[model samples]
Target: METFVCAGCGRIYLENSQRCGHCGGDLEERPASGRGIVYSFSSVHMGARGMPTPYLLALVELEEGGRILARLADNDEGEPSIGDKVVFSGLSDTGPVFRLF
Candidate 1:
């Protein structure tokens, strides 16, 4: 997986950003292990565009140290809880998606 590491403050982020939000410096692309745990999640009954109804969205706490929102592979995985193990599945045209590793 790929992420951006801030040259100014050494903050690693999963998104491709223009600059470091922390120190306003340049960013460099780097590889990450892409392991994470589900910190929090919710089901959206209504969605827009390509998103289907009653989908699961989770705020994953990346093992590399960043929190990102990604769609769950299983909407019917039952109620989500903190610390659910997950891995980076891939990227959607909309955003990232995750599944149990």
Candidate 2:
């Protein structure tokens, strides 16, 4: 994946930007590690069409310092836990998803 990085301040954003939101400087696109730790998560019993109910939604703190709000896939490792290492698992129609590493 790619992230927007501020050329002036080095701030990273998960989304593309014409300019840096923090410094109003030029933004550049860079490859993202797509690796992070599960910061927090919640189970949603209700969701949009075709979305699996009772799926996990989480905040992943990327190794690059950028955080992404994404759906999480369960692993044989048991329930999701705070600070669990995860890796990008591609995307569903809804959004990007991650799996426990």
Candidate 3:
């Protein structure tokens, strides 16, 4: 039910607003098909940022369009590949972490 509008182009976005800063043309409410590739990733070793240490952070490129940065779920034991098919998980109560399916 949350909403945001781009300051630059006046685009309205629903839950997901990372891509469409303005002009909703490229915006999507959810990751298309829940499938995406791991565009990049990083490991957090410090808890200074308020997140648990040793967590994986990544930018996932959705199959349809747009990219989102999220935390890799604890259940994901295998390393993510660039073109791996990832399924969409529900919004996180803690942070933006998605489960790999």
Superposed on all Cα atoms, the candidates' RMSDs to the truth, in angstroms, are: 2.9, 3.5, 5.1
Whole-model lDDT, model 3: 0.61
Q: Write the per-residue lDDT of candidate 3 for residues 1-101, one digit (tens) a residue.
A: 23344545544443664667444445434324566677887777885666668877888776655567777776646676666566556567555565667
- In model 1, the worst 10-residue window by lDDT is 72-81
What is the C-alpha local distance difference test score of candidate 2?
0.83
TM-scores of the models, in the order given:
0.75, 0.71, 0.62
Better of 2 and 3 by lDDT: 2
Q: Candidate 2 lDDT, tens digit per residue, 1-100?
A: 6778889998766567689888999989989878899999998889878866888899899888867788998767668889999998886776778999
- Measure candidate 1: CA RMSD: 2.9
On lDDT, the leading prediction is 2
Best of the candidates, TM-score: 1
Assess candidate 1 and give its TM-score to the true structure.
Answer: 0.75
TM-score of 3: 0.62
Model 1, residue 79: C-alpha shift (Å): 3.0
Error of 3 at 26 (Å): 11
